[model samples]
Target: MENVSTRRSGQALLVWGLLVVAANLRASLTGVGPLLDQVQADLGLVPAVAGLLNTLPLLTFAALSPLVPRLAARWGAERLLGGALMVLTLGIALRWVPVAAGLFTGTVLIGAGIAVGNVLLPSLIKRDFPTRVGMLTSAYATVMGGVAAVASGVAVPISEVAPGGWYTALGCWVLFALVAVLLWLPQMRAPRRAVQAVRGHRLPWGSGLAWAVTAFMGLQSLGFYVVVTWLPRFLQDNGTSAATAGWLLFLFQAVAVLTSLAVPGVMRRAGDQRVLAAICSAVMFLGYLGLLVAPGAAPLWSVVLGLGGGACLVLALAFIGLRAQDANVAGALSAMAQSIGYLLAAAGPVVFGLLHTVSAGWRVPIVVMCAAAAGQTIVALAAGGGTVRPATGEVPDRVPAPR
Candidate 1:
């Protein structure tokens, strides 16, 4: 009885720790964009340099994600996560130094830590809660979205009264990171999983389905980041107040959070994700179209995007587990999807802005976003079946047509 009770306690702790992980995933990153002006003023940075501050983390994600699974294979997922949390804590504090070098360096560390967490969590869920992948994936996604939205909403307000303005607001995330580290201590001490199954020596790079999954992951991320980076400015440029535009962006994220909670229930009875994925893609396309066609209804379009984008995020994360045969494959697939996904997403904003600059209007850029969403649907249909595949180095031709 005592053993069973202890195990239950441990499982609960793990879930709590993962929720904390979800919280940490975006809070630190999201808070910065809102505080960018303050950071710019304090650091005496050029516009290009200030923009680099935001782009640095995604670049770190792109560079570091592919290496994390192998590290987790040797170090054990629990210990790796604990170490990542520690790094995140250090990065958060170092970012508070109010120095330009400190800011950039700390941001890199934060990304390195989060890159590990982002790849591991889905695989861990596959290992521990095999029967409940959809539920738990949505749970973490909801937590991530909610915390990110709140972080972005509160950053400016927090900086206004905090001792060091943006520095303090940025550093505030360390408190959560520390708590995650403390809670994760027990997981590291627990017996590690067999190392052979998840050696991650061979990612699913050769599989066609794997590529489809990666494309879905990348395209969804591309749309989301493009919207996140430009939505406020687009609103403001169209004659909205800065404060109102910020609130609209917050509403956009809030809707995503609320919509994420409903995804698991949809996944429960559905045999495959084909319809759901298609719906999400089409909805995002419409949202972008609405933005391009009628900027005055931006508020409504924001909510529509939140609904579609949030669901897309949950599906993208869940696809790692859903498409993989086991925890080992989940680990590898997660690595492949995110390494390429983030790299693609990191380039999205730059390309999105370039479109705007060359055309001298938002039309060309938004049309491109609409095109990306259309592309997302093609990959979604390709990857949406419930078929699970192994980590073999070849593509399967027997995949069922999407219903």
Candidate 2:
């Protein structure tokens, strides 16, 4: 029993440390959005193709996510995460090079680096913070969301003030990656214990529940990236200045940070997340309605949307951790969800752009997102029922027939 207590204390440290590393994951991507137009104009990219720039990262995430668990199992999670951070840092630093190929390669590497981190984090929480999975997960996710907001919000202004142009603004995130690498360094060198996960497992990812979780996570993420990548431009098209649109996007992301912090705590206590998911989708619906009908008051509606969307993001991640019974299952589920989810998310900006081009307005895109959100609400309800999976380490002797 005394040994058990000591192990718990060590797990706590690891969980917190992993959270700090995860917090740095999204800043590099979101930080560049406000400066994308500047990049497009300066680099001679077409506006339509500019949307591809945002979607490219998601595509890489989808393609790369499936490999993280295999790498983690063979090399160990700490080593993989630490190595990915180095790759991520190098990728960020390289984005400033003069060649267009550098931009594309750097973006892919960044996505790949983040993909590795994304797959491992939930598994870490499942392994380390089993009891407080929801709260710890929420805390890290909140920090992730907040840092991303700050990066996106300040990118333009910081670029104007910095000497290296927008490259300076984007490159600033390399410091965070360095910090993650520093913190992660100790873990890599530490001796493995019986308690620490040495390998991740393979699961039949095509199962019904897995697919449901994947689609729910993916579709919701699709809506989110769409808004994050294009909402500023949407506002600009609707007559707002670029700076104001960026701030409004900032406001949207800010509210999401708050919900990411609070919603998981509440849902964990509530002991279910279906209602919360539905409510989140509804909030997104209202935000879309406001944006579609009254473009001027986007600040107000953005808060509502961000709140719900952030909640969805946190809950989606929490569910991934909770639904799995062990680090391996968590890692597998995380990979499957992200593989499918990021694919869904990768479609957002490009599809939204295509839809906008056809309709010559934001109305059609808003309508499509609303429909997707409503469908997600139903999936969340099924996922929240606490029946899709049993507790960790208790896989059924025989697989039950699919629903």
Tens-place lDDT digits, model 2, residues 1-403: 9999988876666766787787878998997777777888888988767666677778898998888877887888888888998999889988877456777788888988999888888877777666677887788888898889888877888899988888888887888788888878878887754443426556535467777778778877987898887788888887889778888888888988887877755775675677877778777777778888888887787788897899888878887777665566777788889998999898877788789989988889888887887788878877654434432453432222111
Q: Which stretches of candidate 2 lie over 4 Å from their true place?
A: 1-12, 193-201, 387-403
C-alpha lDDT of residue 80 in model 2 = 86
> Which one is best on TM-score?
1
Could you give candidate 1's per-residue lDDT for residues 1-403 as a string of tens digits? Answer: 9999998998899899899888899899888888898799878999888988678888888888888778986888888888998999999999889899889889999999999898899888887777788889999999999999999999999999989888999998889889888888888888886532245646888788889889999999888888888999999998999999999999999999999999989988788888899899999999999999999999999999998999999999988888887777777888889989999999999999998989998999999889999999888887887444665563332222222
TM-score, per-candidate, Cα-based: 0.95, 0.91
Minimal lDDT window, size 10, model 2: 394-403
Residue 326 CA displacement from its true place in model 2, Å: 1.9
Colliding residue pairs in candidate 1: none
Best by lDDT: 1
